[model samples]
Target: MPQLDKDLISQPELWSLVMQLSDRRLTAALLPPVDGEQMILSHIPLPVATAGSYAKAVEEAVYDNPLLLSDFSRIGLLTSSPRVALIPACLDDKAAEEAFEATFGSEACVSLREPTWREAVVVSDDDEQLLAFFRRTFFNITIRPTLAAMIECYRADGLWVSCEDAVIRWVYNLDGNLMAANSFDISAPEDAAYYVAALRRVVGADRGTVYLRRAGASREWCAAMADMLRGASCPVEMVNASPAICRLGHSGADLPDYFLQA
Candidate 1:
């Protein structure tokens, strides 16, 4: 949505800062914003570059602009970013089930199946591109933690964080930013410890914190993991990012009277 686009455009420093926090896609060729209902292909940021035109934008001045204009008509740079999937009740009622072979001026596709209880999958089109993933509310709510870090990056660092379900997250905190992110599997005990151990390996001796969501209902195992971290001297918290910030195009409209009150 343009909401995020506009926000990023206004404070690109935050956007740049987040990359330091994660190994996110490192480039973006800007483009004109697209209104939701427009006939544009899909929900994506950055404009499509012309055929082999990555060469043209390699110079000065024109490349300095935050927005780029070209006539590829079908291919946009930075469109197929590696995306992470999380399980949240936010989109729980969402029933999107279909393997779409879509062409969103780039690449966008998903496998749709009603999540069994709360488990999902995340795939990658490339090491730098998030290919396919699911967001099931009943599963481990990973999006908010990563998203929280993203929002946090917007304020102090341009570092970004995201997950590929069950596996540890890919953190692009900074060149010397030794932070780590992981989406622990909440359904099992062994996996949770394994997740923390993986985190230890990733963050090394850096002062790092672990975040988990208590939404969608988790067992004491999650809290146990938190305690285990404390015993190991790792700062850990069960942070909640529910109803987090309101995203554009989400949530049904409020009652008509609410609008009238204003």
Candidate 2:
């Protein structure tokens, strides 16, 4: 039987640890169920370049652990690799496909089609590490509840990003539907301009309510991104609450099925 060391963690503390580990590039994380049917986030240290092997290890780790098999439903992968692309529903399938191919090649990691948006979760890291992981383990292993959950956590959407030393996360209510996700490298000076441009292109001109989450150390980067969004006329709110708190409290929190439906 495979055994994973479990710890009972509070919402606040868990977010702190997420930020810390994200800084170290342990982008993908697991939220395992604990007593009382609660969930506690956990991470296994796997360097970005070793994602393929990491996925194999995860398969082995959950091979016999019923708790992991039942509870480890969602996996969050943080990367500064291939940036994210969000295609609006307005685009026809052909146009959407072209746009996705142009931004990210055919070997994108996570591709999700929603009623309102089509997202390409591209992994642009060296040697296509994430792509190999997906091909070797993602299909064979049952990870997320659906493709939506996979990208929501596993890839970069408007929701989250883990840059060099900080993770910038966002959640938004879009036309009565909420999409929250995060990815990295968007805040770094070298990467910020491209990230901002991609973000604006995906979101377009909309009256969406958005909330930003980041560590204190990441305040500057977060503010920079926020300022850029506002410049593009995005109605974004830099909330005082932590990302973990917001994610855990809300009904669709933690990438639950309710969130996907919403």
Candidate 3:
């Protein structure tokens, strides 16, 4: 087992526990209540085989990390699923459910309305047991789609991309309003760049910065993406994690920019 953060265990109520569940791994960050630093940044690789195995993997990971057992002031869970869609916020409950089912083909979903974005984010995952485990373990756990955080943090006119393993999540904001929030599965940097260019053309965003999250991305990948975007006259900028979201004693030098923006 890895060394646990003493502060996180000793003063659990002073911090906020944030966990991100993605297709590749489960990332957990113990952040301060306000704009401070992170107490712990840890992750465990998730088995990609089945949902039952996934729940079991998460259970083992939580048990392995003693700090995760602490009761924090706030708990947020970000679910990174490709089965996420954005619908108008004005839709009624039945209408929203129909829309979600039309796209995702299932009713096992959670819809969150973001008044700022003027849309509702619908995230669907078949891992009911995994979600149940989280609800059963934590109190008042706030679960949301990962893209919702990007939409909240980045409120400018640009393209924000977060790369992780074989998945690429992106949000396009135009004139300080969210226009698109989506993800794609890619095998290489070029595949992401291609989608970026295509989105720019489709959205008519000819000249806006493309901010890439510095965490979980390689220098080579960033460089290649920058090179590709340069042809479209769009400059690519790498955004680092906020200083307020740093590690316990050290700076959040290696953390993702979207740590706890939600």
Candidate 4:
């Protein structure tokens, strides 16, 4: 419920840019899942950032130096055994802090900073061995930021849920950064409650929008989700569309980056 203008960059300008950027296609290799396992996380270039003037700002604000000591822990599997990880963007402060703890434990410091209008959450992790190594050589400490910190920079205030093989929901900001994500079976009653609960955690008693993927399987389950959210008196506006399109009655032309083959 707090106003984001004070901590964030120009919301109106960022939203306008995101809308325009969502239309372009990203140039990432489409690697198929190996051994029945798909990569859990991917870093893709925002095609719209290729436009004039926006490129430098996007890189400087959201993608800064790392807060981690080394890549051995986080990217060890990038070449041999990669797994995809999705993080939703629309989280309350507590949820966001908890997520940071999950990754860095007590070995790091988490901080949020906004340059211009884009807010970037950074993690400064200095593992002992790495610190000793750097001090022995350059006499300086090394701090690297995790992907979670970079994603948090998006500062999404809304939630976006969609279904693919199973039910996968992502919290995203209007600027199109996905902050957090979870997957589950929509057919199960417990799952339905879980979905509602997730939304509740994000929106609380406030009104927000929910999107059900426009697949046939999503209709009935999504209807159930809408019903439960309404029952709890949460003013939710549900839309049936590809995750790219969360708002109803849009031009249906733009394809969101999530739908890309990265």
Identify the candidate with maximal lDDT. 3
How big is the positional error of residue 134 in model 4, measured in Å on the Cα after superposition? 33
lDDT by residue (tens digit), candidate 2, 7-89: 33333222211101222323223332332333343334434355455444444443423333232334333233333454455
Better structure of 1 and 4 per lDDT: 4
TM-score winner, 3 or 4: 3
> What 10-residue stretch in candidate 3 is worst by lDDT?
110-119
TM-score of 4: 0.34
Reference-based TM-score of each model: 0.30, 0.42, 0.84, 0.34
Model 1 TM-score on a 0 to 1 scale: 0.30
Candidate 1 clash total?
Answer: 22
Give per-candidate clash totals.
22, 12, 0, 24
lDDT of 3 by residue, 1-262 (tens): 5434444466788888888887667788777654444456777776547546667777776776777778889898887766667777777777877887788776546444334454555445436677788888989998766777767766777888876656677878776577887878888888988988888778776677788875666778877877887876877787766656453445355455566664
State the number of backbone clashes in model 4. 24
Better lDDT candidate (2, 3): 3
Name the TM-score of candidate 2.
0.42
Please report, as a residue range, the 10-residue window in candidate 2 with the lowest summed lDDT. Answer: 12-21
Stretches of model 4 off by over 4 angstroms after superposition: 1-157, 172-190, 202-205, 240-257
Model 4 lDDT, full chain set: 0.35
Stronger candidate by TM-score (2 vs 3) = 3
